[model samples]
Target: MPPFDPLRRRLPGGLRAEHALALTVLALVGIAEGQRLGPGGRTTPALVASWLLAMAVCGALLLRQRHPVAVGWCTVVGTGTYYLLSTVDGPLVLVPIAALYGLASSGRLQAAVTMAAVMVIGVGAGALAGTGDVNGTAVFMLTGWLIAVVALGAMWHGRMAYAEEEAALRATQERLRIARELHDVVGHNMSMINIQASAALHRLEKDPAQAESALAAIKAGSREGLRELRRTLGVLRQVDEGAPTAPTAGLARLEELIASSALAEMTVTVKKSGAHDLLPATVDLAAYRIVQESLTNAAKHSGARHVVIRLHRDDAQLRLSIEDDGHGAPPGPAGHGASGIAGMTERARALGGALTAAPRPQGGFAVHAELPLSDNKTATERSTR
Candidate 1:
């Protein structure tokens, strides 16, 4: 069940907190006015008029959220009229103060500032005219209170806007992450499957045995692609669900990845140094994806017959290099959605790492990535447990 919130709880007549606040202000103002007009100080008609004005001033707060500026002005005018007619002072001042807060909190700084200025000036003017109940000291206190309320409301508005901006930024980053995952998963397998299918078609009648092997590779690639796709989609579909039981793709699956490239008729070699198993999950996954994308690019774009993957692990970082002998392909548009290179670069940079893809001066293409191993020791310990 979702957590309970008092603000969300329904009040009588389906009223919310705003309605409750308005009613509370009304009651308090009414009681203060009643005390001011003790016994038979005022006639029945005058008493009724005073109560009606108080109700109107407080009732205007109900529509403050939707029409804050209008409600603010309404309360200001109503409160001014109440003080003008009524001989004694009451708590009717709370109504306009609430409206001012509503205006400022809704990002209406100009309107709120103007309303506050009007209230302060009107109170000062009344004091100078020796009117109803406002004295010089009352004007000074009222000015300070109005300024503080506007400042608080503006601060609240800024905080809320910052939170919304941060939420949007996080959402955009998540979408990019999902896009990269789908591209790497689907692109790598599909490239292998396409190569195998082409090979099978070419040798179908001429070499039936070789054709059968190619078809088998295509079948395996498709099945693996579908499994990975399902796993990815499953994680996407989860909402308040347990974490996925399947392990994420990482360097441990590097051998299987290299084996798949053989179906494309490419001889791929891996040269490694240091302990690869001690790498952090993020670094491991990034290294695996960099190699996978490089091989996929070679199979589809470059006419490469041989590829070399080199991994060098140190205490602080994991360095990866994937190079192909085939002539390098021209760079695609510079964006994650256009080519896998941009996606790989993004993944590396996201982990406080760096990646570069460039054609070799002699021939072919090479991709080099440096991924940090910031939390590898802790991650290794946790994995062992």
Candidate 2:
């Protein structure tokens, strides 16, 4: 058997489902009311008209989801009509409760509140005017129920709105993560390829051997760039097929990244001060991205001849600093490097770390990040040492 779906199986499907369920419950209640009245009381025309009005109000609730405010008004009007015409006051309040719930669920809090107020007022007026058998206790009980129903609807609306906002926030974060991955994979490799192509063009006629070496570097860079692109994009298609099995680039691949540098007249240097061990994968990936984005920016805009990347670690934190002796920021607003800086900042923040990229007072630009080490890994590192 198919799994039980309360919405689809136990209840009828589509727009009429709520109405159908409501009508069924009302019918069962009406049968019980008839049984209580018996043959002598049931033959009255007023009693028959009251039952008909109740059914009509229940039918009006069918339109509640699509036209909540109008349905609320209609429900109030129908209840008043039933009160004015019926000599007997049976339990006919279910219609208004259902209508109010629907109104509140549809995000019509103001209308639902107004209708609930009108209901309370109507109950008070009925009791005061000696309409049918409405009394003080009935009025008090109904007023409290109406207020409680309205409050319940408000809570449902609040919960629904909160859920929607959370879903939208998750979607936005996913997109930002994808964009950062693309920037890391594409930006660094493209800059190196551009630099190599420039070198090849400059030395093609004057020095054929150097030109050939530049071409070889270009070929290698292109291949590596393609592989990295596939690795990043494969995540999107992972549900359909397997993603790349190759390990992601981290500090372990720092040597290969430095060797692949083709920036014009720039020497990249890497310095380490502590043993690189027991770093969380998140911090490792974020550190690698910070370094990659920093290098890409320096290669593209900085007129510096040398860039220094320093990596260090202590008992509780891993620290990174990339400083370049380049033409610092221009005089105006933050320009082309804004996205890269923002991406790096977001990555650091996500991992409970901090990153800062700014023009140094010493005529250069610097990017720095401090990533935390997990407690378990810190203990393991101490034990191993």
Give per-candidate clash totals: 0, 0
lDDT values of the candidates?
0.80, 0.75
Give the per-residue lDDT digits (tens) of candidate 1, residues 1-385. 2332322211223246667777887887777667656466765666778789889887887876557689889999888888887776777888788778766766788998999999999999999999747799999999999999888877777776765655565566778877888999999999899889999999999999999999999999998888778767665775787655566788888888888998889999999998646777778887888898999988888778999999999888899999998788666676422479988998888777889998898899899999888843322233334
For each candidate, give its TM-score against the true structure. 0.88, 0.83
User: Residue by residue across 1-385, what tens digits does model 2's lDDT show?
Assistant: 2332222221125466676656775685477547546566755676677677777777777766556678778878887777776654545577777677666665677887888888888878888998657889988898888888778766766766765655565566778888999988888888888888998999999999998998888898888889888888876874769769766878887776777763345789989898657677878888888988888778776766688999998877889999998997732356467788888998887776789888989988999999887632322233334
Candidate 1 Cα deviation (angstroms), residue 197: 0.5
Candidate 1 residue spans exceeding 4 A from truth: 1-15, 35-45, 239-243, 275-277, 334-338, 375-385
Give the best candidate by lDDT: 1
How many residue pairs in model 1 have overlapping backbones? 0
Error of 1 at 108 (Å): 0.4
Q: Where does the lowest 10-residue lDDT sum fall in candidate 1?
A: 3-12
